[model samples]
Target: MLRYLFLTVTTLAIVGCSNEQPQALGTLEWDRINARAIASEAIVEIYAAEGDQLEKGQQILKLDTLLQQAKVAQLEANVSVAQWQLEKLRAGYRTERVTAAEAALNAATSDRVTKDRTYQRQLELRAKNLNSQNDVDSADNRYQSSVANEKKASEELHALRAGYRTEEIEQAQAQLTAADAALRYGKLLLSRYIVTAERAGRLDSLPFKLGDKPPTSAIISTLLAGDTPWARVYLPEPWLSQVAIGDEVSIKIDGRETTLNGRIRYIASQASFTPYYAMAEDNRARLSYIAEIDLLDSDAQTLPVGIPLQMVKP
Candidate 1:
């Protein structure tokens, strides 16, 4: 009992003497968007550069859109033409198409009547033995062929007067759909001429200026990271019991006192081996839980990335 009591007292004394204060740390940076791909037309304007501040949705560039404007007008005309054609089909084939078919049928019928009269005369001649059997057969075949031609021409007229068949209309409608999609795609390409600032931040590493051409998918610039700089600090076993998220703590920065509001964003469920960077005499053979904290900063521009920071706990 005496040995156990001594061990308990020593552990409590060690815990009571431990310090939980903010360690001076460096700043952090935010990730960047690699936006590229400008309009292939003439480069019109470039509005941003390195170290320049930007607001959300601010226009950053422009390109010549003369050809694209003309193309948009042309697409509109095509839409009108397609709609007119569809209307004509819906109203049935035009009178002119039907008229042409009727004319052809009349010609066929006239030819058939003439051939039939010739066949009748040839039959009479064969009966009287004045004509050969081959002559009568030839006349009969010509009359039959003329009759078939007349039937074909009549059927053609019927089809034309019936308007577009369902299948034909469907095909035309499909073509219209394809044309609409193409026009939309062309407009999208046209809009790519202008790029904008998506977030509010300082810019860095901007490469292009007015009239400079950049390649597709190139990283020309970055929004220098700021706003409540964050750090992933490791929590050792000694302070495990004393810490939780959202605990208010005081930190020292460049000899100035600063307070940070921390919330436990995440906690690892299981810990394996300790990382190499966390190795030391007191920290050796120990595993740690990571805590992400947002540090407060007054100047938006001064915070750089990858700064060491210490977290304080109440």
Candidate 2:
């Protein structure tokens, strides 16, 4: 009976200790941000170097923009021309142009009248045998030519006063719309030439120096974020089952005297072998769930990544 009582007490103690123990163990880590080249262009200048601290949206590098600038300029010119054409179509012919066309028609009409009167005189002379048939024929040809000229001039005046055709106006409008869209696209392409940091962080690595033309697939630089570092830990199955996300815990940085408080931010749904940092003889063969702890105190910022830390479950 004494033996049975001792076993029951020991079982209770083991269960109680398991409840208070940390669920996972891992090293501190920070999220890395990468500045990648999004355009295929030659690098013109690098405003930043490795280890440079940068704010969000800061210019990290600039690609050669001469070609892009030229393209945009050309597109702008096209847009201007299209706009002028559309405006001219909408406004119709100018008053001065209409007046000129009318004057041309009137001059042609007067010439036609003079030619017709001369041809009639030649016909009367031919009938009296005072003029040869060849003279009548020449006058007749001149009259006919002048009549064609008058008709041509009259058509020109009619066209000038009638304004642009509906189809022509619509075509001009479409051209203007197309030109505007092309200009916008050219400007958008130019914007990609200036490479900017997507987040506030330290410039971790720059693969290319100034004047280097790197491939578009190459990462321009990697950024170590400025946020507080979090602990990346792996918990054995036993501890994994005991801890929940948002639970408060104590983190003691290895070789540090102070302990930091933090909350569990993540718990892996799948289990894997214990990572190298967390491996020990006792847990070497164990499957552990990965977990993350967000340090609550400012001390986390002072700590570097890969540092060992101990977490105590509260």
Best by lDDT: 2
- Candidate 2 lDDT, tens digit per residue, 1-314? 99999999999976775565334567888778766676667788888888788999998888888888999999999999999999999899999999999999999999999999999999999999999999999999999999999999999999988999999999999999999999999999889788888888777788888778778767877888857888887777777657899998888887888789888989999988887656544446768888888988986787777888777754
User: Mind sharing the TM-score for model 2?
Assistant: 0.64
Consecutive 10-residue window with the lowest summed lDDT within model 1? 20-29
Residue-level lDDT for 192 in candidate 2: 78
Clashes of each: 8, 3
What are the models' TM-scores? Answer: 0.67, 0.64
Cα deviation of 40 in candidate 1 (Å)? 8.0
Name the lDDT value of residue 24 in candidate 1. 22
What's the TM for model 1? 0.67
**Which pairs clash in the backbone of model 2?**
25-233, 25-234, 26-233
* Model 1 lDDT per residue over 1-314, tens place: 99999999988866654532322232333545445655444457878877777887777667677888788778877877777777767788778889999999999999999999999999999999999999999999999999999999999999998878988778778777877887888788778667777777667666666666666556555665445556566666656677666654444333335544445555455554445554443444666666655555455135455554455544
lDDT of each: 0.68, 0.84
Where does candidate 2 stray beyond 4 Å?
Answer: 1-23, 94-97, 100-159, 165-171, 235-240, 268-290, 308-314
